[model samples]
Target: MSEILLYDIPRKDPENGPWSPNTLKARLALNLKGLPFKTVWVEYPDIPSECKKIGAPPTSTEADGTPRYTLPVIYDPSTKKAIADSYAIAEYLDATYPTDRQIIPAGTEGLHAAFNKAFMDSVYFPCMFTIGPLSVSALNPPSERYFRTIRGDLLALVDSVRPEERWRKVQAAFEVVNGWYEKADNGKVLLMGDTPAWADIVVAALLVCARNLLGRESPEWKAVSEWHGGRWAKLVAALEGKVLYPGYGWTKQGGQS
Candidate 1:
């Protein structure tokens, strides 16, 4: 058994599971590859301190030299290494585990990086602005006040916009993702044929968060879930029980599937 530690943020229902896309992506990779890990629940405010304790480098340093930290870090006890960031962690896992199922895929790191960037910018960027409020609202209650005091203020401001128009922007982004899936899928529902790839995990992480964070009751959730003929629905179903995340298994019935 490999000793692995995953550091992630708390979902609104921490007792249930995680809701961070980056962390969720890391978890998905680990689960699909049959790697077992224990999760270290890190609150928003403790990121810097938690990261420092593990000797993980900060995301950046301020002019005055303050260390800034981020989430989705993994510590491998066997190798005695702590890696930060989703992309770096995925690559590290691929190298360490050397499984037949490769998320980054052999000899395609650069291509996958570019593809992930495209999804981040085109699909996730606009969705960020549109779903910003819902995302924060899904944070554990303790962090909600803290988040609202910082970036949440900006995200909530966007919520005041007309819901229909706000949804329009998000819809356009989903269409782009759907377009890519149409190209990628041959006779299966996954991105790279029958097998689930890292790219699938990358995209699924966001949708999973969206479904779990916003909750099915919210209009934002409805619009996102319905977009592209609920294309995400099928992918969500395929990967649902394979991993344990806040929104890993959901349905319109208002119950965990």
Candidate 2:
């Protein structure tokens, strides 16, 4: 058995804000694999120390020897390996525990790889493009209050993007995913088939961002909304405290504060 340690922070909502997809993906993989791990929660803007302790460097660091940030970093004490980046971490877990439910699917590595690439390109890119600018714009006297304001601005941006536009892009992306699911025939599960796979976790985590942070009233998310409303409820239920932050609530279930 490998000893695993996870690092993350609460969501902006304080109730049910979404966890970083990387964190969620790693946690879900661990759960699916029936692995036990220790978790540590850290405050934002101070994640570099934690990253450094785990042997991963922060993307940026302050001049005073304080580290800026990096997230969803995992440390495996048994192997002395630390990993950052959601896709890399997920793939590592999939390969590391090959017998533990096989989230990535066998004989279709290329397909899964492509799905991941497209997912990052479609979902994460747009999200960052929209949220990043808003976050920067909300800067104030530089306090926690300012950070909260920035978070609010990002949320508002998500809300301001009309459901129609959101849906069109999301639906197109999902259609590609749906086709993959159909071909894989993994089962009736979302993303890759009847059973949840790595692709499902990736997509689900993205949807968590959209619904929990962005708002859930988009026509673009109809299929996803329905799935989350129905079969995928278990995933949400399981993630109650682990994936959703304390105050932020999930939009689909009327759980956000």
The numbered model that scores best in lDDT is 1
- Scored against the true structure, residue 238 in model 2 reaches a CA lDDT of 36
What is the TM-score (0 to 1) of candidate 1? 0.85
Per-residue CA lDDT of model 2 for 149-197, tens digit only, reads 5356655666787756755665566566555555544345455434566
Q: Which stretch of 10 consecutive residues in model 2 shows the poorest summed lDDT? A: 247-256
Weakest 10 consecutive residues of candidate 1 by summed lDDT: 248-257
- List where candidate 1 sits over 4 angstroms from the true fold: 15-17, 61-65, 156-161, 217-223, 241-257
Q: For all candidates, what are the clash counts?
A: 0, 16
* Local distance difference test values of all predictions, in order: 0.74, 0.58
Question: Which whole-number lDDT from 0 to 100 does residue 124 have in model 1?
Answer: 76
lDDT tens string, model 1, 36-142?
A: 67677777888888888988877766557877688889888888898998888888889988987687778888889998899888887776675567667777776
